[model samples]
Target: MTNISNAKIAILATNGFEKSELFEPRKQLMEAGAKVTIISLESGSIKSWDQKDWGESIGVDMIVDNASESDFDALVLPGGQMNPDILRAEDKAVDFVKAFFDAGKPIAAICHAPWLLIEADLVQDRNVTGYKSIKTDLINAGARFEDSEVVVDNGLITSRHPGDLDAFSAKIIEEVKEGIHKRMQKAA
Candidate 1:
């Protein structure tokens, strides 16, 4: 297991986030000793989307508007059709994502969460993967899209869907342990 005992991770999501995508990674990271915080568009709790219905509610640790990239070592974006679609439209949320990229911090986006990367304009020329529905959007954003369980490009890690959670969580732990990437620094 990768040890990240000193690392601080920020999970950005809102209502409609894929339940497993957010929970699994958060669970694994915490188990590995990382301090994980849920950052969202609002205070209080955000509901999850599980399969065809609403899932459990996850408490928000901090609002996006109040979050600072410097406060966390890495970022995680959980996907669900509604989650990313809604986040992509929030200017503060988009800017919050951009700040993480600008600081060259490691970012992990699973499934539809790549939409936020596209919104932040950080996918150009990078290799990434996401749920099938956003393949074109990722390609148009200049990302070399792949159909894989997980793809780690620089400090950005992405995966296809919930089934890829194991690989996705592993890669996130690996990257966070590796720290900032040179590619991200150059892009920043």
Candidate 2:
């Protein structure tokens, strides 16, 4: 630790999120003494996609409509194929993501979660990494793609998969402690 005890992190997700992708980072961040809030598309708990089948559910702390980038020090986006796919379609969810990026707040997106970044046009010209399946989509959206455990561009953190959760969570903590970054206004 970087002493992120005062950092408040918002995890944005919805039904069908990858089980470990969401749980691992949240667990690690919480252990690191950061306040982590689970924000979702609805008020109730959201189910997870555990490996090949449906997994457990995690309670939602606040709906995307009620949460704001200003309320937290950073943002985390966990990916399952369906999670980001569904969230990217919701204007409120997408706007929530965009607001964090627009303010230069620390954001961590693992696996397919980068889809939300693409939808918000935040990945354009930014260095990023994600699950293999989304690499093409990221490149198509103008992100400088890399195949790695973690990639940190300014305050934007990205990783390949659940296996990289340790590095992913660590980056989020480190970035949150470093505070806001000065982001260039990438042309949309």
Which has the greatest lDDT? 1
Q: List, residue by residue over 1-188, the lDDT tens digit for candidate 2.
A: 55678679999999999999999988888888899999987898999999999999999999988898999999999999999999999999989988998888998999999999999889888899999998999999999999999999999999999999889988988898899899999555
- Write the residue-wise lDDT of candidate 1 on 79-152 in tens digits: 99999999999999999888888787899999999999999988998999999999999999899999999998
* Candidate 2 error regions (>4 Å): none
Worst 10 residues of 2 by lDDT: 1-10
Taking all chains together, each candidate's TM-score versus the true structure is 0.96, 0.97
The candidate scoring highest on TM-score is 2
Query: After aligning candidate 2 to the native by TM-score, how far in Å is the CA of 160 from where it should be?
Result: 0.7
Evaluate model 1: give its TM-score: 0.96
User: Clashes in model 1: which pairs?
Assistant: none
lDDT of 2 at 72: 96
